[model samples]
Target: MNHNYKGFFSIVLLAWVDADYKFMWIDVGGLGSQSDAQIYNQLELKECLEDGSIGLPPPSPLPNDDQDFPYFLLGDDAFGLRAYLMKPCSGRTLTREELIANYRISRARRVVENAFGILAHRWRVLLSTMQQMPLTVQVIIESCVCLHNFIRIRNPAIQNIQLDNEDGAHNHVPGLWRQDDNLQDVDMPKEGNRDTVAATRQRDYLKYYFNSPVGLVPWHDRMVGV
Candidate 1:
């Protein structure tokens, strides 16, 4: 089996969504071989984070009042752990606390997936592979995403598109994790492979928050099966 297959060229589509599942920013470029972290590093997100222009709400008063709670982006294992970008804990032998953290993060991350599904459903052009040049394809994808956001804003009813249950092959939840064409492994420095001390402390703070009265969800334990 030849693992170096590069038959079909592809472009990475990086998008950010709000809690309401609307596209806030979308970057369409980069080769399909690029990992999520690589593509993300090329974006202006770092600048935004530094400038404090993301409009994050003030932190709520949690049990741990010492640590500052900043807004963050939720990503999967393919991405690295950063102060602003959080990924689930790797490996299967996770503690109960880790399981809860993963579940909460996954639930929050589903917003991006839901946004993609809604875009594809509204704009049929994204349903199949584009035959046009990479640049042209990027334009088409961008246009579709922009239009999707436009329609979402003007027509609020379009937001509730029966995503919970469907028939046949589409029966799964609209936002469930699905393999993307651009998925690839990310090579991290051995020393930096682990989450940074600040990131880990922040994650631990959130874990405590999730189990506390302020952030506790009554059914979270049963749902996560921990």
Candidate 2:
């Protein structure tokens, strides 16, 4: 992604469970530091999302499932994500379905937002100007995200987020993942645990407490019928 220096630089790719919290997804254009890690090469992103290094849930769930879920990717105008989303997805379009799906996914993917919010509030760099050169900007931004995740784990918030044994599939809980307890300093695990096949999914859940805004263009086209 060639970030428009005169315009919006490549935003940091952020994915999180939303306030409502359902199925998770990430967005782009928050901070751009880690863009390289995200595979700036278009072919690479496609290949990665298709048959590559990582597996996303719902669209790429654990071994045993009969249904294949269509990925309802969302983002702001930046990220250029609409193109990624517009490609023929599943059985195809229906009125309000995309919005409905977006709502559900956004709910699940809000953790990153809160996490980012916390990071920005903590570091104050995110609140600073994006006018900086792309290279410098991306480094600072990514470093901060890595730091934020680290701190959250090292000093967990008082209430442990006891995930429901079920993946909140049917009962999508909103804004409940964050606990109200005060955070105390502790040594949180640096590397994520890989206990079961489900552990990969668990790591996904833990990744990106904050992120880029998923595009709204898909919804926009749906609404305007462009």
Best by TM-score: 1
lDDT of 2 by residue, 57-170 (tens): 546432233333334344322233331222111224643434444443444434444554455555656665567776677677667666666655576452124222223234
Poorest 10 consecutive residues of model 2 by lDDT?
185-194
Q: What is the C-alpha local distance difference test score of candidate 1?
A: 0.67
**lDDT (C-alpha) at residue 165 in model 1:** 34
Q: Which stretches of candidate 1 lie over 4 Å from their true place?
A: 1-7, 50-68, 165-194
TM-score of 1: 0.77
What lDDT does candidate 1 reach at residue 75? 71
Worst ten in a row by lDDT for model 1: 183-192
Clashes in candidate 1: how many?
0
Q: Quick one: best lDDT, which candidate?
A: 1
